[model samples]
Target: MPELPEAETMARDLNQRVAGFTISQVLLAFEKIVASDLKNFEKTLVGHQITKVARLGKWIKFELDSGGALLAHLKMTGQFIMGDWPGHLSGQWPAHTRAAFLLTDGNSQQTLFYRDIRKFGRLRAFPQDELLSFLSQLGLGPDPLELKPEEFHQLVSIKKARLKQVLLDQSLVAGLGNIYVDESLFAAGLSPYRLATTLTADEASLLLSHIKRVLNESIAHRGSTVENYRGLEGPGSFQDQHLVYGKHGQNCPKCGQALAKARVGGRGTTYCPICQK
Candidate 1:
């Protein structure tokens, strides 16, 4: 899954390239990818100008001048790319193009394609009221980048679960996934297997600092392209900067001890067995 950085990169890139364009039409190759009602989805987007694009957790939010929003979650293999308007025929769409937004700015037109090879991503168009209601019902946590150090420490202190589980829980702190959690924990010299309540206030603050640093750095690099993740610009190079997220049994970069791998809440986790304590 593309985490905070990937989503942020997509938002920034799209905002620069596609903001102010009106949705003249919409095309869907895989109708199941629409999370909202089909008729309403097209009705809400067409003719509305996109004012901005932003990241809401692991999802992308495209704000409309008319107060509606087009939201998308790039689940496993989903990504957005630029393309030309195609015929209504599905055969005319690019490979893996699940959805396309036909955008116009009076003078010219463009197409923003949502391609998902795994067909696991989702796209939704919502009126202002519906968007608020859906987000509240979805129960997304506070943005990780916006939280103060004390706020983050207090939030984690009450989890009482494994550090890995606490960090990965979207309802507690949004925008964190397996890759960044492992990397942040390794940077903080903390073990994922440790209980969340075991950390001191200072330790928790340190963890948050590292988490913010890693996420910002990853965004600067456009996010890790370990799988099918890319921005309108291109694939990210942060994967090359990874310390231990995918190293598994490889030797730890810090202490030369083999990195340990295990499952936490059913997600694969890796850490330095000796350095992280």
Candidate 2:
């Protein structure tokens, strides 16, 4: 699962590698992958020069010179990689590539492929006005990296759900998934089961600090690649730095007690019961 760090990595890599490239052709191996109208999807993308690439919460945004954009969400197992154009036959596509964009930088050309093993991802094309409208309607909370301490504390003070569940709510605070939430809570010495409304202002600030730290560190390492997550460059190495995520029943790094495993908001969570308590 590619969260903020992974999305950040992809956006950064794309800005560096593919920015300014013009979309010359659009090919769709699986039309359902597009969440927008089929009539305008390819027509709006092709012939547009990519002005920039960015991430809004967990989604990737591809900005064009014409003020239009292509937005992609790599839902579960989706990712982007460089590839060659496939043959006319559908079977000739590279493994898991549902869509491809042939790009040209005047002198050179390349192919950008969207791959998803589970086919759960979605892509959409929008004009300038429509893109702004869509983003406004998405209703995501502040990006954790840009969130102020007071803002985090205030948000936590209003929420009534468990700490982990509130953190997982994109509407409350965007970009936190199971891995970073557990890691942040453990690092802050807070239990995932703790109610968000019960946290003191100082504790909420402390948790915010830990959340930013974990996310920044993961972004630096290019995000965790515990599963199928891969940036434009390659798989991330941050999984090597994980403390509690996916490490159930293992010895806690902070305490000798065995790490406990449970479900918070139906997401598999891992933490040190002794330390977190």
Candidate 3:
């Protein structure tokens, strides 16, 4: 699944490329991908102009001039590609393309394709009032980058689950998934199995700092591309900088001991046992 950095990269890239463009038409290859009412989805977006693009946790928000919003969640293998329209009658859609938005900027036209191999991703177009209500109902926690050290400490300390499980919970700290949680824990020299309430003030502070640093660095590198994650331009290069996410049985970069893997909260977790005490 695309985490914070990956989703952030997509939002930033999309904002840069398609913010002011108008949606000339919308074609849904797979109607099931639409989370909103099928009839209202196409009616709300066909003539609207995109005003801004933003990311809320793992969801991308497209603010429209019509006062509504088109929101998307790239669940696992979803990606957006900007390219020439292959013509509706050509039947030349790219592999796994679930939706396409034909965009125009007065002179030229481009199609923004949403591809999802697993079909778990979803898109929704909501009215202004309903959009606000729907977003509020998600109950996502604060973004780690925006949280103060003291605030982070309090949030983590209140959770009774294991540290790794707490970190993975979107309601506790938004935008962290399995990949970044493992990397953040490894970077902070903390064990995944440690209880969340057992974290000292110092450990919590260090963990919060590392989480922000790691996420910013990953965004700078365009996010880790372990599987089918790609920005509007291309795949990210951060996988080369991974410290311990998928390096099970590999020697730790800090210590020479082999990295170990275990199931923490039913998620595969990798850490250096010698270094991450």
Q: All models: lDDT?
A: 0.91, 0.91, 0.91
**Colliding pairs, model 2:** none
Instruction: Highest TM-score: give the candidate number.
Output: 1
- Report the error of model 3 at residue 241, Å: 0.7
Count of clashing pairs, candidate 3: 0
lDDT of 2: 0.91
- Residues 177-269 of candidate 1: C-alpha lDDT, one tens digit per residue: 999999999999999988998888899989999999999999989999997687888899999999998898899999998999999879899
Which model is ahead, 1 or 2, in terms of TM-score?
1
TM-score for all models, in order of appearance: 0.97, 0.96, 0.96
Question: Which digits, one per residue and each the tens of the lDDT, describe model 3 over residues 53-158?
Answer: 9988888989999899999999989889988876665767788999999999898788889999999999999989888888788888999989999999999999
- The root-mean-square deviation over C-alpha atoms between each candidate and the true structure, in angstroms, is 1.2, 1.4, 1.3
Off by over 4 Å in 1: 86-91
As for model 2, its CA RMSD to the true structure in angstroms is 1.4
Model 2, 129-203: lDDT tens digits are 888888888988999999888899998778889998999999988888888999999999999999988999889
Model 2 spans with C-alpha error above 4 angstroms: 86-91
The window of 10 residues in a row where model 2 has the poorest summed lDDT is: 82-91
What does the lDDT come to for candidate 3? Answer: 0.91
Model 2: lDDT of residue 147:
88
**Clash pairs for candidate 1:** none
